[model samples]
Target: MRPRKLILCVEANEQVLSVRKFLLETRGYRVVGCASAAEAIEYLQGALPGSIDLLMSDLQLPQMDGNELVRRAKQLLPGLPALILSNTVTGYDRAAAADAFLPKGACTPAEILDRIRILVARKRGPKKQMPTAEMMPHEMAVAG
Candidate 1:
């Protein structure tokens, strides 16, 4: 059997967090819910490397913005997929390192899961061989 995907969800609103946690858990994902940016950061710092499959956060977070949190999360786990949540999707820049934005109460759980799956699949692309000592400098390649 395939391991259930682990998703780290960061949100300041307790009600929203609870709802998301319940929804995600019921859908077969292992959800790690954090109440604040600080807590999320702390979790990331001590978490086993690559244990988290995706990072999901609210755009309006207390203390640190979602974009900043996503930036820091990616720094620790390169190629980590991210999803930004908001009450209304507006003024979001795709260049901000998030794969997609899910509007609260406006989208279905299946839609949310579908987007997460797409991001995970995109991140887990075709693998490539790492350069060996005998490989020429021109032959060196990196796969995302």
Candidate 2:
């Protein structure tokens, strides 16, 4: 069987954090829930490369907003997939660093799960390779 995906979830609100943690855990994810950006950053810094599959955080964090967190996370783990959640629709415009964004109360659990599944699968998908001269068709290569 495939190993469960590891997710680093950051949220300031305890109730929201617990609910999200439970939701993801029950869906077969291994979650590391943190109540602040500092805690999440510490975890990321100490974690092995490619250990965590995703970073999910709330938009309204106390110290650092989710976009900044996503940016910092990308610096640490270049290709790590990130998802930012917010209670308002306006957060989408500010979530440029995240791979996906969801309005907290607007989305159902199924929708959130579906988006996460898609992002994770996308990250695990085969990478596209640049075509070398030898890989090109004979005619195309000769024409170049």
lDDT of each prediction vs. the true structure? 0.77, 0.85
TM-scores of all candidate predictions against the true structure = 0.79, 0.86
The sequence of per-residue lDDT tens digits that candidate 1 reaches over residues 1-144 is 446678899999899899989988876679999998889989998887768888999988888888888888888887788999877557276327677777777888878877876665566564342223223324423211
Q: What's the count of clashing pairs in each model shown?
A: 0, 0
Q: Candidate 2 residues 54-128, lDDT tens each?
A: 899998899899999999999999889999999978899999899999999899998898788777766666544
Which parts of model 2 have CA positions greater than 4 angstroms off? 127-144
How far in Å is the alpha carbon of 106 misplaced in model 1? 2.9
TM-score of 1: 0.79
